[model samples]
Target: MPLDEDLLPEARKSYRYQWYVVAICMLAYVFSFVDRQILSLMIEPIKRDLHLSDTQFSLLNGLAFSLLYSVMGLPIAILADKRSRPLIISIGVAFWSLATAASGLAKNFVHLFLARIGVGVGEAALSPAAYSMFSDMFPKSKLGRAYGIYSLGSFIGGAAAFIIGGYVINLLKSVDAVTLPLLGEVRAWQLTFLIVGLPGIVLALLVFFTVRDPRRRGLRRDADGGVQKVALRHVIGFLWRHRRTFAAHYLGFSLYALVLLGMMAWTPAFYIRAFSLTSSEAGYLLGVVVLVANGSGVLFGGWLVDRLARRGHTDAAMRAGVIGALGMTVPVVAFTQVGQLWLSLALLAVAMFFASFPMPASTAAMQVLSPNQMRAQVSAIFLLISNLIGLALGTTLVALVTDRVFGDPKMVGSSLSIVYGLASVLTVLLLWRGCRHFRRSVAAERAVGEPAAQPEGVS
Candidate 1:
């Protein structure tokens, strides 16, 4: 699936534009994370204000967001493939930004939960369109690198959310003595949500003005001014025929999500209880680890995968996922077992490094393996399963098991760690299985004379 040598010069030039796309997408992703996860840092204040429990916090973070987000992903992704992606992304950003701002007005769990759903609905447009755009922009040979850069946004954004969330909360707490006019003596949590949510508005405007819509090259407009060839049923049927491949990748990613989302959702609390770090300190340190370690892992993994693909190893990406899954388990174990804060932080960085490597590879593999038209829907389907199962159930189940079964704060983090370890093991197993079938399927696909899916919009 490598590009021809004659096209290499153009591909190199095209890669520059792909980096631009990455930069913009990364900014959008950062705002998304800031809005979504800033709530976690304020969990203590929110919980105390609302008289909620650990399980309720889990629902706020996981289910309320995932429920609508997961369900709406497919239809939105379908719209992205057929309509203007830049427009879709712009509208999504605006909607989510507004929702994040609205969260500041929430008076209770139900109001906040509804706002979270809005955030989820808005953010779901990003991955499908961004991934599709990457496929179109870059040549096939350069997609791994392009995707790697795009994937870095996730870590950078997530890390920023942690750091910024903590800082905003602490600042609000300190400034309680300085009362304001309309919103007098705002709690740390309320101010934290308000401050973090505001930046997304500017980001939404930037996306609207800067990104140009890429036209679908081969499509013909019907009398109604719609592209004639994109059929929803056809995409579903293609996935149905490739069930095993899809299932393997789905399970692999879901297991990865289960552990990853669970750990991230609880890690701040864990640091509070286990390491005695203030929320701000934990957030700052976590941000550094994510920005450096996880970000490098993403870029490196993409570079490695692209290099391997050039050498005629098509399964290199999946193999990277397998190796990353295995390596991640080590740090997961070390972080849970070790008591020292420095050691645990170091291991957490290592864990994030390995954990991030598979993201671009896995996402690229899914897109490459799918037919061009089905990319968004397939991505949506995977997101649906991964979010509903992993995000919704993963953290909630762990919290219930720890608080209800174990009956102690100290035991909660350790108990969740055990769940993470088991999930990591399962991720490796499923990815290994997927790797076995990937080469055969890819070869068969190429032999049948279907055009290899190219990197979209690299130029």
Candidate 2:
């Protein structure tokens, strides 16, 4: 897997600095998530204010963000490959933060859609760059934990969106509308956007100042020892060579993303409709669930990935993914079927725990399998596909199923169950096969690397 020789690896600084880099990346990720996810809790107000149907709202939720977000990742990731990652990430953080606040200024559906597009473009700068950095900073054996630690920002941001937004929204409920100095009158939800979105700029500054781009390690080289050209064509060629491994990795993890994101996007609506709880109440409860259940769940999954790999499980990442997908099937599908509130919540929490496993697993698989030059490009392509499938198609599918098939808003819970259940079955099958392909790919890559790793003229 170290196809790019780490024979001349970068000298690592103190462990604290390594963790510090991860910390900064994680913090930026948290702010990015908050800026995006705060919209979930403000759904009712936005729909009511904008006069949007469920489908239109779903379009705003999925396509508006994922469209440009998916498309732009390639170029941004390309930049990350050769450029300074911390600067790229800092620019992204500032841009998205402003975009999110700009969401508060949106007067109509088109306005909000445009603003969401901006958020998507900005967020595209993350992940690939961060993933590449993590691999360079830590050893392959520890990559899963590093990525998992970084990924907690998503859950933390999700929980923050709910907890913080819930309190602000609840407080604003007492007031019918807030009148900004120049923007005139708007609802609490509008102001809530400004409240949550603008703070990320500060975090952007922190990342810019504190996070240094680690020296790039494990570079692929030509037979004569010159650095190999890093171009889009090279990445394409590499993927073509390992088609089976990537196809399984991309599709399987994407389906898992579909299941996980589908639940996160719609669960608030489900809680509100099925349990007769207010938006604030749903936010508060989901906040706890996301933090306690999802937070701990991902950490455990990362730990398990490292454990399995240490035990000589070459396909440990994919194996872990299959286990997670299987574990979630019953809980996720059955949660909505239950009538009792407590039982439903319990099932929901359990599903969330297992649903989180695939993220770090996916990252570990990509970084460990590919050479360094290809990491960000390959990662960008996966993000493009994954977001389009998971966020765009998955969210839109749930909304369409609710609107067209069920023809009722209240059946959203059933729609979620139907979508998630099917996706779960599909994810398990793909990832189960993925384990074999991944093992073969790893073996093949190691064979090529062994001879390249020999001392000069040893042969």
Candidate 3:
């Protein structure tokens, strides 16, 4: 029930040291995403070689990774809230990296599915723990920028998956396969998996050695001024009390995620199919858009939130979400309908810029709303729902439309347009309404204080 003085991040560390940790943690995040997303570029090859349909391939890309990735986040987050955060993250990086390498060994659909699940399980550890660490290490004023910088890894890793992975795919075209020392034979794509997946182990070691868990700041305390681990029921009650706030955040941003990640997952395939370009070409083009357009967009989203918060806007996150959704809707919808390649790419870049806002904004919203102890739990819950909607349902939405609605794989662009159009409208409406609820929730929390107990008869 007592606070641990040695666990305090501010006790002996300088701001520079704090930022160094953020950088390393961001690198780990980069590794996690590269392992998670490299599968996007290999979609056609994997589908062709494995003798699978679009829906089945979607299962491997979305369901297999996201189902466990989202679900396993909760227990891992609970452990993060109570244990050594960096050590937990380090183990996760290693586990997922090994899993990525193991994906090269897959001989069939089932083998690949299980390997993807392993990658998901390992990745489940990084964000929740990293978020918990960042919230503790940085002050509220600087939180958005810190998270924004950290969130940059998603695009950076994505770029690597495209640019570097593209180069590998291109270079391997002449060769049929490579034989390794222990593994007798491996496919070109399999070697790509091996190349991208193995470096994460070293990053894991860097995280474990250099980073230590900071003392729990902003802990929920009782009348006696003693700290206690929040019980499961209490966490539920707290969430229920702020139900509208969490609902908007979960659904609104999730719809945003559904569209954002859906684009990322399928856009490469769209280029390959629509323009008859190779995967490497599509990867190179999309990789640049992802790095420059989406990357800056997320950073600007974080800066926007911080600027709004500085200007006394409590609903900054929701406001930014709405703004981004509005900016993205038309371009995303029109991008897929365009016949000219240059025009389509331009619209897609515009769409990507606006699509990346919710990354940092959503995290900042939750971390600010929940107390320190409940941050990871709340984040895990959000991730579970968001990833399900974002990756699982989002990817499937496109594939399902292509398979069932259009009955043609070449119509993937049309399918992407339809999903993005619907998702964008829903996102704008939800987050617009969320701004009012978020403001009200911020007021109520301030009035009741951080450890607000569930008041009776609200249900």
Candidate 4:
């Protein structure tokens, strides 16, 4: 997957625009998470206003969003493979941004739930297109770094949701409520959603204008050297032919995501309940950790893997993922078990750091293993599986354990421990298996041919 081999003439000559594309895509990813994750910080107010239990709120946060996000990603991704990826991304960004604003206007649980669904559908269009574009823009060697940089949006957006949301909520708490001209009085939570959602419209326009779709790489061409349209069945057949590699990849990452998303959805509540911190306090503290620790982890992991790959380690990305999974387990378990706030936060920070590693690696693997024509579809399938398992179950499982098993809402920390600890163990096992299959897959591809062509002066 080295860039020298896969990059087109235009891309090989102009490296600056590639970085610009990554930056813009990263911003789109940032806005996606900001709109999606702001809900976690607003949990208390939302629960109170809607008269919801932990289980009910979990449904709104997890299932309502994940269902549409997972189901719709495939078709949208297919469109991305065939059409203008930037344009598709622009439409998605605008749709999700509007949906996020609409969330502020919801008077009831159902309305808010529907808005979240829209947000899910919109956000689904992003990563597949982004991943495909990155594959075409960068050489295989830099895929890890490119994806890692793009993935920073998750932490940045999550942090912004909390830090910004926390400050806004704190500022507005003293006042009863703010009255909008036509909207009448609005709660602090509603205003928080509105403030975060509107700016993304401008971001969408920026994406439309700024990001260019690169020529597709690593595609199967006809006798005339024209790229063929990859059929859906062809994509399915490719996956089936390499089922073990994909199975391990998908299952392993889904397990990792189960732990990651579970922590994200409930850590604020865990902080509130365990340390008696206010929502804003919890948001700000965790926000800082996510921005710093997760951001650092992603960059470090991507750089490490790229360096390893350059040194002739074809399985470097999978190795990094395995190490990350193992490293994350102890800190996450300890974070849940610890009673001291400082100790717990420290543990949580370490856990987030390691948790960030596997994602860029996973993304790199997807690009390396698939043809360019099939890359978007493969990515969509990955997201669909990961989100369905991770987003759909991550929060709900913790809530179920708290409400049903512990029979107490305050035992959320224990529930997180139970869920994440088990998931981490499973993740380690699956990733190890995946590493073996991934290496074999890489060898198989290399044996078939040297990459399309190694461009001079690209690296």
Candidate 5:
């Protein structure tokens, strides 16, 4: 339903509050990515220090982190809905930050594994609560753009982590080269973790001070005279009723993640192997691409969706996502197959830009389709599936296949490419399904009766 123009005065006031919520959430998201991604930059150094194998490194990068993060994310997300989001997020930031710092002290695989798990546990507080909050803040028309801008935190933070982490690690190596006796030179990887981890302490404090809970009421009330509190059984019922919509969106999103996460997991190593770029150079270059391409793509996608939604076609923004899927797949397939460094980078940059374009629209779709009360649980389910199946398996599957099939480290790059190509096919198919069901979902939602929700923007 369209917002009443008479409500404009109240909405403008609430909009300011929404922006504040977005700002804090964005900071928390950046910290989350920084802490999580620091390990990727430190991969080579950690392997050298511990004499670890590629398979083990892949596990550290993929399974160890994803397993715990995926398992715990849903439960914590449910708690985020039930409790104070900012407080929960603040505690989470502290837990992950300290865990990341503790990684620097690890002497063996077991210790590092535990620390990674801790990071995952802490980082789990972010998406569900953040999503729920953002949904309350923004109206459906602006949700796409809001989610898009908010999603840029991943791009900005991920890029900065790579570039800053690379420079810091190089400096640490230089210090080690000089060999001061009293204050022992830290290893490149240890320095990377320490630097990345420290910022979260400050970010956590900001989250506590800045974010307030928007008193969100639901569109529908139950027998108890309040919004229905979503339970496991309720989630099951929701799925049963909306299975086709859920399946289509989930499949498309998972395929999208499969390609994206798989590439990100191994892209640094690929740059090292294929382009002969040092860790520092690869980190810096990739960081720039993430900032320039991914960042702008997110912002633009969000803005477009918001504008489009105002035209009385709410699903128009989602249609753009279908186009993005096809556009991204072409560049992605080409970039992977190419051998030249400059050409490959150009293609990859284009791919990243388009690949991220769907983020806001997809996230908005989930938010719009979900009831107010069930938003957090549903968001948790999305995270659980995406992380566990797509992220956990995408990289590891390729690495395992490459190891077994070719018995060479070099073959792993191609193996990564192949997995992405296969996933692209699924991306196109599922997105098509989602587009078909879009109007029906909106209609069904309206038939159930529209609630008088406050007009807020996504952060």
Candidate 6:
């Protein structure tokens, strides 16, 4: 039976209230990335202190976090699907923030690696729940913009990590050590971690008090009006049934993530090593570029897709993603090869702009294809694949190429070029292929009525 209009939960909330939820979610996302990406700015100092190789630092930056993050995401997502999403998000925010602060206290590589893993576990709970909530809060037609706004956390958090981290490091450079009450004097890198991690606890509290769990939509409810639990296998089957769409979506995004994560992790080091710029200089320059250029690209992509969808382009989101992937390829490759710092930064600005363009469109596409009951789990799976491939391999790939293939750590720029250049080619190809399948999926949903495509309340 078609769902009655009165049975849907979204009718009760004002659009303004819904957008406020998005803003709060965006803030949570900002904190998550700030904790995650702050380590990127301090990589050189941390590496020097720990006497680590590029490979080891890559493990801290990528694999340590990705391993636990990707693994824990599904179960946490299952919890979010069934339980209170806001509570889960608040707890996650607090846990990760504490863990990030703990990273500053590490005495050795093993200690710091474990701290990174804790950060991963805490962060795992955020996005799946956030995506699911946004899906319920916004109408399908406007999801592109909603997700675009939420994804701004990535750019904002990332830019803030660099800008704040750079200045903090600069301020502490003159002071040899920072002394806390219990802990003895700590190095600047350690203090940086401590400073960045503490504020998120307050943000977590705000989310807990301010954000409410909006009722789930598009699910079967019992006679008493409670949502029924969905079985895991049924969710898998739905994905299997639409395997082509997911395969292309997952692969395309993962490849794009490979380029995105690789650039984000390495670009700071590139400017530092390649141009002899201070961390502060690289941070400020790249931060401004990411803030303005990448931020604009994300919003523009979302607006473009929403406009196209309104004009009767059912596959507008994925089509927008394809354009972003294509536009990013040349500049990413050119940015690495350019010798002059100014030319390189300019190229990097262009690359950041185009690189961010596909994310909102891709994210919104996933929400559209998923049934409400399976949205969070599906998002978890998407994150698992993308992070495993992107975060795990993105930094490591460049490190391996530089350490072994190029045999020079200073050649990080060339390594970034080689990895992203190849990844961009693959990204364009995968998104292009995915577009046709995505359109077919949308058509099928509209034709059969999406709810009838799968059995309901299959716990």
List runs of model 2 lying over 4 Å from the truth.
Answer: 1-13, 450-459
lDDT of 6 by residue, 1-459 (tens): 555577555534455577888998898888888899989888888898889999999999999999989989999999988899999999999999999999999988999999999999999999999988988776766788888998888899899988998899888879767788998888999999998899999989998998889877777555798865687796898789889998988999888888887888999999899999899888888888888888888888889888888898877887888888888899999997888988998888888888887778877888887778888998899889999999998889999999999999899989998999999999889889988998898888767556422223101
For 149-219, candidate 1 gives per-residue lDDT tens digits of: 88888777888888888777667666543344775665557666777777777777787787776544323
Q: Which runs in model 3 stand beyond 4 Å of their true positions?
A: 1-13, 451-459
Clash pairs, model 3 backbone: 7-215
Report the lDDT tens digits of candidate 5 across residue range 117-169.
88888888887788888877766766776688788888888898889887887
Better of 5 and 6 by TM-score: 6
Q: RMSD in angstroms, all models?
A: 3.7, 4.5, 5.3, 3.0, 3.2, 4.5
User: Which residue runs does candidate 5 get wrong by more than 4 Å?
Assistant: 1-14, 175-186, 451-459
Please, what is the whole-model Cα lDDT of each candidate in the order they appear? 0.79, 0.88, 0.88, 0.88, 0.77, 0.86
Per-residue lDDT tens digits for candidate 3, residues 1-459, read 343566455544567777888888888878887888899899888887889999998888899999999999999998988899999999999999999999988889999999999999999999999898888877777788888999999999888888887899999989778999999899999999999999999998988898978777878778898986686677788789989888988999999999998888899889999999898998899889999998999999999988999899989888988999999999999998989999999999999999999988999999888887888989999999999999899999899999999999999999999988999999999999889998988888888776322211100
User: What residue pairs are clashing in model 4?
Assistant: 1-140, 2-140, 2-141, 3-139, 3-140
Ten residues in sequence with the least summed lDDT for candidate 6: 450-459
- What range of 10 consecutive residues in model 5 has the weakest lDDT sum? 174-183
Residue 159 shift from truth in candidate 3, angstroms: 0.8
lDDT of 2 at 129: 97
lDDT of candidate 2 over 427-446, digit per residue (tens): 99999998999999889999
The TM-score of candidate 5 is 0.92
Least well predicted 10-residue stretch by lDDT in candidate 3: 450-459
lDDT tens digits, residue span 403-436, model 4: 9999998899999988899999999999898888
- What global local distance difference test value does model 3 have? 0.88
